[model samples]
Target: MLGRPVSLIEADDASNVDTAIKAATKLVKDDRVDFLMGTFNGDVAIAVSEFAKQENRLFMVTGAHIMDLTGSRCNSHTFVFMPNARMMAQAVVPHIVKAYGNKWFMITADTVDGKAALQAMTEALKAQGGDVVGSVTTAFGATDFTAPLMEAKNAKPGAVILNLYGWDLVHALKAYTKLELAKEKIGVGGMIGGEQIGRPLGYANNAGVWGLIWDPKINTEGSKRFIQGVIDKYNHTPTSRCYHGYAAMMQVLEAVRRAGTTDTAAVIKALEGHEFDGLKEGRSYFRAWDHQHVQDVLVGEAYGKELGLGHYKILATVPGDAVAGGVEQNQCRL
Candidate 1:
């Protein structure tokens, strides 16, 4: 896209903030990379973003969902490609309230990302006239959810929100299934889930109405093409995480092409307020003020068995504009 050969250098951040900053420094000073992308942890992403700003490099966050990245900590050098906790909560909370109930309980991982999800979901639920009856925080990677799940069940909430991701989410779902919480008429869900979590948890244990970043069932031509491309190369269906990496990189490269140079300032200007094919059914764009990627957020219900290409049956495709708060609401000065 820059009209010259580009070299990609990747370094594992080890999900640690210091490691991420050190790796980013090497990529900038040693590898001399012009742009940085990809970090899943909110803390790591934020750290790398600060580094990017100091070093004058563009960093595209692919997986982190913390709102601060595009809110209080927002900077011109950093762009978030994944939906934030607020967006996902606003998109799914209404559906969850309607399908499950107004009273909810939460088992949240005690990290910035998890706390963001807890707050977003709580606010979104309260906005819908719902309330969080109870909540408990667990360590970020806690394996045993017995205490929190039991406490949640004792509260007898109409639904439970698992504000977690990765294996933490997987293990929580397993414990929920083991407890047979659904049989008691208690619904469960969270801010995000898809093939990445479901594949590991398996269909039998994957239950609830959850937010999905992307699913194979989306019928858009771009979605079809992206899915096919992944299948061709990886021989496996692409997950939401896969889509985040691909889409974020595509946008960055496209911005570089439009700017006709890899100059950081020009690329940032090219990306701000830019609209593109999100590979989903919605108008996707980076809000000029916050640089958050606004797109469709899918609400899906997990079944005991697979339906089509995934475990979740899509329930709603909420438009980005319908849920993404206005610039004033986002509190982003830039």
Candidate 2:
């Protein structure tokens, strides 16, 4: 992107805050990397973002969806490329509320990301004159969700909102299906859900309306190219996680190309308010104020079987502007 060969170095933080800081330190001090990117855990990402700020390096947060990463805890050195909890909630909550009704039961992973999801969903629900009737918090890596699922079922809310992700989400869905919550007219959905969560749970078990980052069914030219590249290189379909990594890295490189230097301040300037094709149907840009990547968010309904490249059927394509709240709503001063 800079018209020069660029070297890449990687480290795994194991989703732990301390481990992530250590790994980031090595990348900045030992490897002398010009940029830092990638994190999957909210707390870990926050810790590393502070570390990056201290070191005066730019960090592109790719996966973690905690709102504070771009909200109250936002810093000039860190830019979030993934949709945060508020963005997802704004896009999906209405569909879920309309499909299932006003009352909700929540099953949230007890962590920063999960908390953000819970809060965002709650706010969105209330905005629509709805409320959470009952909720439960689970450990980050809990494997069994029988108790919580039963509680949610017994609450008999119009829908159950899962403020969980990854395997926690998968396990919850397993129990949700095993207990036949849908059969009882209790719908289920969440702020974020996509092929990544659905594939492991299997098509038959993946049920819900969800906020999706991306899906292969997106008909944009950029989307097609991205999907083909992933299929060719990895021999598998790409998920939203893949989209986050690819798009974030691409934007970072593009910023360097635009700035004509890897200098931190210059690149940061290049990225601020910069617009680009996000491989989606709507506008994409890093908001100049908060550095949140504002882009399209999709609402999808999971099917009992695969629909070609995905297990979810696209229900609506919400433009980024409609969901990404205005400056007053974004609590970041940076």
Candidate 3:
């Protein structure tokens, strides 16, 4: 392991993200935490990013998949470590397009995030020769799926792709099953539709769901050791959240060594053309033009009994550049 001094802290972003901002502001203003990391909710990440910019600390995000963290909201001091919304859509375009071309009805959450997920997926659908027949949007954690799933059931979509993630998606699955929205006639899939989201879906529900991931539970040369490091360090195997967070740290650490100073500008310059040493995608880097880090994507299906982990399934690597979210000038205003 490379010798470095890395201190870790968890901002109480989960309790109230505003509290995360106050904590981050204090670290940057008082303690001067060399680099600010985390508070993964995009809104929290954005707040901290602004603080980082004002204080000249580096705000490197681990896995707050919102597109704006890098898209419209990017700043000189704010950098994303993991893939974003556009990247997610890009990763799965080929599979969804090729496997189930045409007719999609999105059962998206009635929240900002759901809207973004729906947007990214719709863009992907259009790219692969499909049309959104209609969509049903519900609140972030709406308990009732009777209305939405029933609409989806009647729409008779060639596919019904959900945009929800984590626990919300789990309830949505239960509601879908309860509403008798589970359709064998129509192909169904969605982001976070695999092990993490699938585990609660159970064997019967997860059996047919598919998804895209950055890593899989398979034996590969570097992966074995890499995963072991995660397990040893965190007392558990790395979740996508954990792996991407580590990857982001690795990127910033590399930039620090290259720059020899945590001066925001210097590190920014160092990261511009740098190649990160990730375990799965051994050599990865961001394009200077858009700060889009190119890396591997995987296609997987839910299988066997889930160990109540973040995600569990056998995954196959897709072509690294499978989705192709355009990279040149970003939408970031600044």
Highest lDDT scorer: 2
Model 2, span 5-43: residue lDDT tens? 888898999999988988999999999999999999999
Q: Clash totals for all models, in order?
A: 0, 0, 4
List residue ranges in candidate 1 displaced over 4 A: none
- Per-residue error for 316 in candidate 3, Å, reads 5.1
Model 1's lDDT to the true fold? 0.91
Q: Model 3, which residues run further than 4 Å from truth?
A: 1-5, 15-17, 97-101, 200-204, 207-211, 218-220, 233-235, 306-316, 319-329
- Which lDDT values do the candidates have, in the order given? 0.91, 0.92, 0.67
Q: Name the lDDT value of residue 185 in candidate 3.
A: 59
Measured with C-alpha atoms, the lDDT of residue 301 in candidate 2 is 96
Worst ten-residue run, lDDT, model 1?
A: 1-10
Off by over 4 Å in 2: 1-3
Clashes of 1: 0
